[model samples]
Target: MSDASTNAGAGNGAAQTPVQPKMNILAQFIRDMSFENVLAQKGAKGETKPDIQVQVNLDARKRQTEGQYEVVMKLHITNKSKDSGDTLFLLELDYAGIFQVENIPDEQLHPFLLIECPRMLFPFARRIVADVTRDGGFPPLNLETIDFIALYRAELQRRQQAQAAAPATGQA
Candidate 1:
């Protein structure tokens, strides 16, 4: 009787063990980077501060390995002289990370890849931008923190709008 009860208890314990969601970053690195000081000596000599523009974009794709995905965060920055409207400097960087994610529902996977993975990779990318700018004989260009959730939502809206417009334009 005690042996039967022990077996029953073990079965119940196994049923109660829950499968936990998991996300692990396997690796991260700068896939590509380019920095150009268009004006060179002229840019350094200019006393006036240039207007700076920065753009951020995110993309993700599944890797060959199961449960593995690659996410890339691309940053484009440009500085232009306020008075002369000449290009001062331009920098572009593509930073990526390989992540292993499991137990996530299909509905939540897109957000996890677009929002969470990029959030994890942003700081390192930001630091590299700053360092590259400083090393190029200019003051560090510290990027502002990005709002991934908002960006993701905006991207969705933009795509929806484009799809809605496509059929209308095709008929014309």
Candidate 2:
């Protein structure tokens, strides 16, 4: 084969990248969300003053086959009233997005799938969390923005440090 033909053949696959599936928002629903105010009535009456505290956590997982992925974002929330010592609320939401990934190099794909994709879906997830909390009868929760890339890097560092600290096992 001529050099030009050889080059053309080699470039065909690269040029005709696999057409990834379009991200489908098949389902966007709150998996689990709960609210409990132990002293709500008492606090409302001002009989018992309560200090409010809020805590949040984020988690995600990816499942891929061939050239498709299901990315899930789990948001866990807790709200408490201090003075009245009452449990205000607890919410857990699992929001997911179906993504199509194809023809991307491995190095770039990791970050894109792990960080960028989730970041894109976070706002919708946040809205769900806020709506659930508000509909449950409390003030709407405006969650702070999250840096998924930073989180991924921190998690990567943690894993690396853990591996380094672990005693080497004989079995490789």
Candidate 3:
């Protein structure tokens, strides 16, 4: 084939190929972590299981580098003695991951960042929580599987409610 025809054919083939969506986990790290035994020695004496409250929050922001974003998943756990209501332990963890995303449309990016990125980080964060609690003279805290989609939906609903209430409160 002549050089001109070959080049034209190659260009057409490249143009016809679809760009697949891609997500790459560049790095994962514990940005911050804290474990506190509120009662110290007194916290571990009880045989009863503690009432544990776990709260999860997530945030994502674009980085200066193209196609790169940072997602942070924060977990707050507070455990209290069931019988006496004394505080047992307070655990806080901020786990973050750097991701490179390409070819994903803007409409889908928000859900991907809020749900999928944090979902990827949760298992490691859960293991850390369990290990810290077990090493702190308590039973391992086995966190339940989180539903990221549900969390994302709830967050959206909450923000909508807040926005709705803001206008009503302003009128009063």
**TM agreement with the true structure for every prediction:** 0.87, 0.67, 0.87
Residue-wise lDDT of candidate 1 within 18-39, one digit each (tens)? 8787999999999999999987
1 or 2, greater by lDDT: 1
Which parts of model 3 have CA positions greater than 4 angstroms off?
1-18, 41-44
Off by over 4 Å in 1: 1-19, 41-44
RMSD of 2: 5.0
Candidate 2: where is the Cα deviation over 4 Å?
Answer: 1-32, 35-65, 82-86, 168-172
> Poorest 10 consecutive residues of model 2 by lDDT?
48-57
- As a TM-score, model 2 comes out at 0.67
Q: Could you give me the TM-score of model 1 versus the true structure? A: 0.87
- For all candidates in order, the CA lDDT equals 0.93, 0.66, 0.92
Candidate 2, 72-149: lDDT as tens digits: 677667665566556666667776776766666767776676786688788997787778777877778878887888
22-111 in candidate 3: lDDT tens per residue? 999999999999999876756355376689999999999999999999999999999988888888889999999999999888999999
Q: After superposition, how far is residue 21 of candidate 3 from its true place, in Å?
A: 1.5
